[model samples]
Target: MRKLKIGYIPMFRGTARGDREILERISKELTDLSRTMDFDLKIGSEIVFGYDTAVKAVAEMNSFDPDFTFLGSYGATIGSAMIPMDKLKGLIGLWAVPEWELTGRLPLNAFCGSMINAGMLAKFHTEKHIPFKWFYGYTDDPLFIDRFKVTFQALKAIVALQESRIGLIGPVVDGFDYMLVRESSIYDLYGATVDRHHSVEEVIKRAKDQSEAAVKDELAAILAEGSKTCMVDDEAMNRFARLSLALSDLARDNGLNAISMSCWTNIEFNYGNAPCSAISRLNNKGIIAGCEADIDGAIGMIISRAMADADAATMCDLVSVDRADDSLNIWHCGPAAGCLANKCGVKWDHHFDMGHYEGDEWHGYGVVADLTFKPGDITLSRISTEAKELTAFGATMFDKESYQGCSGWIKDYRMGGKPMTLAELLSVIYNNRVDHHMSFAYGNFESSLIEFANWKGISVAKNTGYVDHMELGTLGK
Candidate 1:
């Protein structure tokens, strides 16, 4: 289940029962849903418009940094309210303008009466193409509310780990550390402290060995999936099982919530099954796991939030950067689950040829993953360290069926408001002031992101000349 943070607005427009009572009644529903739904709710106490409501609901959303927003009879001028929150997706306007006493039926006046508040939101965001959704007319409709609550709950559950601690097992591929603007970048942008352990061997050994029962169960799972049951000796399978279990346990033990390891030599030195499969399983379990100990996968972990699930992170790589389109491609290496696709019943695992790693002369294996960024909002971000820049670019979720592979692309992007050629895209990455590595978050979590940065007291956002708005908006003509 997804753990989404939600922002709620309380309404009492000309109600016989004061605003406090009105909010109290709504609070009951919010509380009940929090218990039953996956959504995490926070009441934005700011006024939501300008300044001066006794409650100040707008400031509340800003402070809470909610993933989904609940407009509780709030004023639309509160676009500033939108300014301080997180990714801010899935907007639900709640106008419970009290249709009491003389009412025998519809609360038309109660909801319909908030014309000014609603109009501004539509006008402001529509022009910006912010993609805000609306759900009005709440009554004793438990079923409908329940269903809506599920979706919003999922929305709230979407967490990109604003201050997350991703464990880096050993060093990255020689020069690739520059390609991964992880730890320090997190510290600078999100106050996230990455605790890098000095041992990759330990993690590898753990994954290379697991419990006897888990090994059997895993083998059975693969068997159930129709994988060629015996690719090697039974002993090796048991060893691989033990190692996998150990790796999981170690991550938990060290508080290394998410682990990325350099899986070549260490994996081959002990076991046979490519760490790829095991990593895939862990990712699906909500623990950010990436093969080859790559930081690019960290970007994938953040983007997974857009999937509306803890285990929805896609393991991918930075493929081609298309400057003309102002976009980038994140490619995967295995068969992904069906949930990420707009379709259903898709296979998320498959047999494949393993790359040359450790002492393995030549061995092949199976891997699984949902195609990268399919049917979900694509948020491609990079944290270049050379000059230290945290840049963000994105587009809508674009896909229908679940294709089984890692060879897909996001197309048509532009920089300087002009179509960019592939070469130009490369030049941008090379010449642009970035730390070499990047961070990715599905959809856009800039709101919560901002909070994280502020919380860290890192001046990345507040610093002038930080984001090259000129470059992003093509302002120079």
Candidate 2:
């Protein structure tokens, strides 16, 4: 997880009595909390008590370039809080402390100040909007701490997306037109860069150029891990190691935080090997990798990783729905990280779908990791084409056998705080026209994902069952 930088703006009215001491105490509490939190807090050198002081304080805070700013409403005038609220680039937090005492002449009308500031900012930001969150209660309050932590987690995920550089190794697969996304739209929406100059041939050439010793060492390490190797022989494993090393080098050479590859007919037909193992290896190493050149899927994996504090995320297809058992099966051509494998462990085997191809040589594409996902709470998410929207849901993986390849059975799915039946979930997918691929991590991140979408202004689809309005007029009543 990335550590966030937070700027603190302490506000006070110059004429108000006893505000200086209260502001100082608030600063001390925040500074102490920062030590325990996963963020760095930068407090202004002096409190803002007037317009000129507010301007100077804004300059000082802006120099820190915080990912989020906290405005301590310590009996401050609306004008003072407005300076940082308008000047800061990211989300601003309005923190109002409880009154110090109920006795004579209210020492600090902090809550009233915060309400006035919120009203003023809301009116001023009608045209050019700035996101802000409200907080009440003292720093030691449990509710305050919980909200603060959740916001921090959401901001960290947002920052990760803004800083990501994704490399697309090839075009989307032949029939998967739905995976296509405009690179410019991705940048405009998520602040992530998409580099498409790298080609499939480059990866192949790099794989071939790897030194024999390095390939042998990688193969040895993989074999030493005790995964049962099925039809795949030592040569096939060696080929997978070379490709894995090549992909790793490609990401490093291009400075990519994530990669999406076609990983299909071209690589399988020409290179005589599939990249499922390579994708798994890269994901395990914290370099997010997606199969079939799904750029949005790769971005979703990156978001999952960030939300889950860098846990490896897997991209899988919703293969089947079992109504009797109330479960859904998620599977892919063996690209899941080793850490997600069940106690049965990973199995190196042939790609299940390659046998349908015509040639005898196609049978040699035997290097996929076959395993079941370990039982845990899982969060599934996806970004739509053109980066226009996002969807996320929470489910629990059942501790039961799954079909061949990297797969899992998930039950008890919920979205938008509502428990969804299997039919309802299917309806949501159909109505929304969600992509076939969804990325998942080993934790419940529904709230974090929603928060991230809110922060970025990305639409969140919380579909429940089917929508009557979605029917065509000619086909419906």
Candidate 3:
């Protein structure tokens, strides 16, 4: 889990009894509430009052080195006494308390000050091309709390990406041109980079060196976890488990946060089974993994996991469209996260292509876990590079029952607003040149994704034909 450091600066009109009283009350309330809430935001112990106090506070805030700085106001204050907004780095937020919270004549002029400070900060951030968010409401309003939650989570996701170190194995599979990524571009856009392990040979060699006892224990653990539904023979399942342990050892030894493997002919030709089950196990353990050496896909999963607070997420292809019901089939060979699998719906099985071979028939070739994704709201997201520039897009939709095989269904896919016809939807995907694989989590992360994209210097792709009704008011503006 990621912890967010927040530098909270509280401002008020000079020496006035009403302004001071309200600031004390709200500050105390916010401070007390902070201890009770489960969120990861850690705030400063004291508030700054003016230029002198703000100078000292800014130095202290620098020591803390917060990811976000909150400039809060209870009322309008003397000119030039406000905190030095220019000193802050990263995302800057202006929170204005509602003047209406007080019954009598305006003591705080909070709404007016908020508007003034917001405009000024907006101009400053715009000129600096810095990311920022704001909220205007009483301290107790649900709306205020919700906005804070979304913004903080979004910031957390961005910070996670900035700090990620990924282990990439092999290159893009032959002919999957859409999955290509440049390490320089990834570093520039998301602050993530690749540590390429050129061959799967090292992984295979390490797996073969495992002791018989260790391999037996791993296979036993797999079986105990309901591997019987997989239908794969013990010999093949054991080899797959050994490979899974090898990958986990490599990941831990190298201090990798995520991995992208090349599972086409290289690993299968040498090891006799695909790495899907291994990939699934890694994802279930909160380590992001991607197929065909897709660094971008792994990064997308990392972002989703961070925003969802380590919730399980998976990568699947936007395979086919269900035209009749305006739904799309999300399928992958067998790499779905075990944590997200429907109860009793996971089968340890073989790749679909292997099923067509002589006498093997779905129970041969490679070991995989077939799963029908649990029914719930799903966010489909991708990060793609074009001419060395990275861009992102996300859609919030719901998953339905499995349609066929272990495939999952995402119904009513809409972006911006309004449902899109299958043709229109395909057009947007083609126009944007997004990869076939996307990351899916069991909750709506559209807001966080949008904000994160904006912070990274790209506007999330939107439906120009629709109403543009995504609840991202003034985002990326």
Candidate 4:
């Protein structure tokens, strides 16, 4: 992952009697933090006092081309704050430090300065629409650090999205119209490119070309990890290994950050094996992969991985909503990363739905990783078909038994900081027409995802109950 670049300009009123000692201490602490954290911090050489100084400071920071900038209020004049707020290009941070002592004319009116800055920016930037976040307390304060880290993580995720290059291998599966997305809209909104597209036949040819000697190590590794194998034969396992290697090479050669493939009936019919286990292996290797040629779903997985800074995220469907246990079943045809397997461990098996299709040769033709997801906190998110809205929620996956093929049961759902019942969640999904596929990872990234959505000017669907009225004009309001 790339480290975020952050620029900091400390401001103070020239005439105010401010404590230089405190300002120096804050600077040192921030410098130390930059060394330890995942961002590269560039602090201003001297504090800005007046409009001219503020302008020069802003120019210097702008030259840095930071993803985010911070206007640190040492005891700043309103003009100083406005200068950077107006000129800075991306998300801004208004940082205000509390006074060490209350007596004797207040050493530094930092809080008041920042409050005025916030109000001024809110009014002036409403039209310009510059986004900014508020930060209060000393540099070493725990709460301040927490908010700062979240902001940093959110900014990093945004960068990840903008720089991502996704490969669409084959079109959305037949009849899955909701999985379609406009490539132009995706580039316009997220700055991610989906220019690379390959037919299912092209990938199949690549897989067939792989020699037995080439896939020996990969097959060995896959078999070594599985506690047991069922239904799937040696031919199916070898095909999976070849497909995995082929996908890896394609991603590396094309400089692709993620991939979405039509890994269903098409691949199964053409190649005699589903790409589930291969997709799982790619995800475990940090190449984000989504099945059914769901470009938006792949993007959702990219967002989850970026926010969690984790290598793998699972793309699954909400198969069942059990009111009895207040839990929802999250399952897929087995493309989940091996790291998510429960204590029962990963096993090799045929796809659960393979029997539905015709042909005796197709029996045990689907190679999939069969395992239940380990118990942990999870974050579920999906990008709407139009790429204009995002739905995200957090839940806890229970330790109870789950069905095979990358499955789990999650309860205790929460969205927008409020507890949500399974019934309400189901209503939200159905009424909103959310995509059947949601990408998730084992962590609480709801807040980071919300921040990312806000930064991108994408509307986040509310967690409230279903609404019947259209209200055309007030769509995003």
Candidate 5:
């Protein structure tokens, strides 16, 4: 179980009727939930002191370094000083339901609306460049608990994967912010580091130092393996092969495990056009590399690599990712053996740049492992911003046999679950919410993911298979 750093503030909890006594009652209730759920509750009240609870809350919020922070009832209504908002990883607001007795003396909805204020906190998070989620409702509600636990666990995995370092060489295409996640959020939450990001000039400078003989030697092995080598012609192949050598050497020297490189420079440098076929070769080394130098998609490669380390899984773009459970079709152009564990005929795993359309240098090499768990429970995961961190965790998968990617059924198949399927899990991941993500690991890790979730204060849940919307659609008609 991962030890959770949960944020909570003391001071006041309920309406100011024997305030300390009311707070004590609420604390006891929260304690009960913690004990029952086996969560490590890090309360703000214990850390925050004196006349202002808001100041105390923010202080506690920073100190606890929580995966998620639960703003107790009163803390919301009478906020003291402002929280940096950047400091928080994620947010959860607890609203005490209004009973006749509880509301008669205090404005129930007004305070509940304050719980809504946490949404504003999320807004502030957005503007201030913080990644967070505003989770609200009665803490004891089973629905809330169920979703909350699952979310926290998933959030943890997302953040952890983000903390991962993906070396970016050269430039990415324009207007591609999705590939570049916020640097601060990852650093704050998951200890994610970007390491060294280089440009084409750097690669060229490195390439110049390498002897042509060494470059030729590397290309010899690559050429021997690729039939595409003959089809691509020599002019294009020479430049890419040299680039591949430089990249491999740089990766080894810098201790980089993964990379995303832009292949357009060959044309820009007047060296003829070459797809980033080099990325395919890197993928064979089990080092993930993306074409177009897209960093956003590189995170997916990160997810796949992490999954491969733990389970029988693969990483792929949503295009090749089929939502149907029976067969999640993952394919790559270069490596025949990259997607399969055991294969025949020379058993060669090679890389080549796909995404080519007749004459373009933007092609990429992709590697996909079949990321479906058949028969029993399998966890799906990705590293995304969670409570301002890059966390990773398991997610629900659709049934094994009923899936296929032939049609656009990925989205269709994803629509019907209670955040249990791959689609449902990703549906709510938004600006204020966490990223849509999952980590599918083999076996029933409900216990482990949840145990680690609670210990780390991450969200956790049992994996329910995908919902069958077609059946529901038929019923609706």
Candidate 6:
């Protein structure tokens, strides 16, 4: 994958003298941060202290073309910084570096300038329809960095989607007519190009072509990685290994960032096995695969992965509701991501119930990684295109440690609104025509998603209904 590029523009008042020192200090800090941080950030070298200089710097940075531009006010007042901002097409964000405390007057006036710029840009962006974000804090604060990183990742995901090529192999499961996505709609809304491969036969053929030695080696690796194994006989392991390798090659050969595969009737019945294990393995390795040929689910998985810093995300059905505990059960027949598996480790298991279970032979070699998801806060997101318009919604869910074999409960749920009853939540989902499958990754990414929605000019009517206290389950009464 390509590294996320971020251009840094240090700003100061045009008439402000003796500001170069603070500017240099902040620049050097960013340089050091770029080397230390795990996420990729490409900081630009130029500094802006005037309208003319700002225009020149922006022009130069434009040539470099960053995913987002960071406009920082270091010891300078907020004046005409908006001049350069008008030219940028990507997301624009502001950094209000905290003022260094002293016995006398503030040295940088950084916070004051940042706040002013924020207010000014808020109006400017609103009137001009420009997308922007702002943060006020010390450079190294963990919370500040975390929030910024979330925004950064969101921008990265948006850019990735624009540059991505997604593959849809085979048709969606029958009767899931709603899940069939129009490629033109994806291109129009997200700029992602989709290619449809009409047959799962190609995947099976590729799996069969792998050398036996290679398949055995992959099987050994899988066994070693698992903390515990169950019912994973040689046949299942071998089959899964071949399928996994083949899928990896298919993705690489096609230059696909993600894939949506139809896994029901054709691949499972004719091939005598489900591709759940292969899907799980691909997700663990960062090649997102959505089951039942869910293109939007694959896109949502990629979005969650990027926003959560490449954390593994899975596409799962909202299979059951637990009103007693006020949670929803998220399950997908054995395709839960292996990386999200709890300490108990992933189990080699069979499909839930999809097979010929007659007297003599049960031909379904389910071949799946089974485990309860690890307990943590998670975000649920789904993207859809209906009526030629793109719509998406995101909310946070608290996953519990309590596991029942191959599923996890979203015992805690919060959307941007007043605290809601389980019924109210269900009503919201039902009323909005949400898809059955939702993509989930571990993190509280509600704010990030909202910001992304703003930048993309996508409607946020379904998501913008909550206050922060709702996240704490307080309802903000």
Per-candidate TM-scores read 0.53, 0.93, 0.87, 0.93, 0.47, 0.81
Estimate, for each residue in 1-477, the C-alpha lDDT of model 5 and write its tens digit.
244456665434355445455456667776777776555777654522223546546766676666667654443253333354345555444444333245465533434545444554555445654333344445666645665666555544444464466677766655544455565654554455655468767776666577779878866876564434224445455565676677788788877766766654432343333433455556655666655565544554454444233422333333234434523332233211123222211112112433344466433322112112233334433343433223233433333332211111122122123234444433323212333323233333343333333433444322233354432221222
Return model 3's CA RMSD, one decimal.
Answer: 4.5
Candidate 6, residues 119-143: lDDT per residue as tens digits? 7666755667665677666567864
- Summarize candidate 1's per-residue lDDT along 9-79 as a digit string, tens digits: 65433333444555666777777777776567886554444324423555545566666666665212333
lDDT of 3: 0.70
lDDT of 2: 0.82
Count of clashing residue pairs in every prediction: 57, 0, 2, 0, 54, 4
Q: Which stretches of candidate 3 lie over 4 Å from their true place?
A: 39-51, 78-83, 100-105, 122-126, 228-231, 354-356, 359-364, 385-406, 417-424, 466-477
Each model's lDDT comes to 0.49, 0.82, 0.70, 0.82, 0.46, 0.72
> Which segments of model 5 are wrong by more than 4 Å?
1-4, 10-41, 47-51, 74-140, 170-257, 262-288, 302-330, 334-412, 415-477
Candidate 6 local lDDT, residue 25 = 70
lDDT of 2 by residue, 402-425 (tens): 887899999998998778877677
Q: Using lDDT as the measure, name the better of candidate 1 and candidate 2.
A: 2
Decoy 6 TM-score against native: 0.81
Q: How should the candidates be ordered by lDDT, best one leading? A: 4, 2, 6, 3, 1, 5
lDDT of 3 by residue, 1-477 (tens): 456666676766555446656656666766665666543343444455556766766677777777877777777754344436667656777777766445766667766766666665556445655446777665577667777777776887878887788888877788887778788888888777788854688888878888899898888776665554445677778788888888888889888888899987568877888788888877777778888888878888888888877557778888777667767788888776777777665667777664445564434565887778777766778876443323233443444666433467666565644565555566556555567788867666677777777677764665544333443322323
Candidate number that wins on TM-score, 1 or 4 = 4
Poorest lDDT segment (10 consecutive residues) of candidate 6: 468-477
Model 4 backbone overlap count = 0
Candidate 4 clash pair list: none
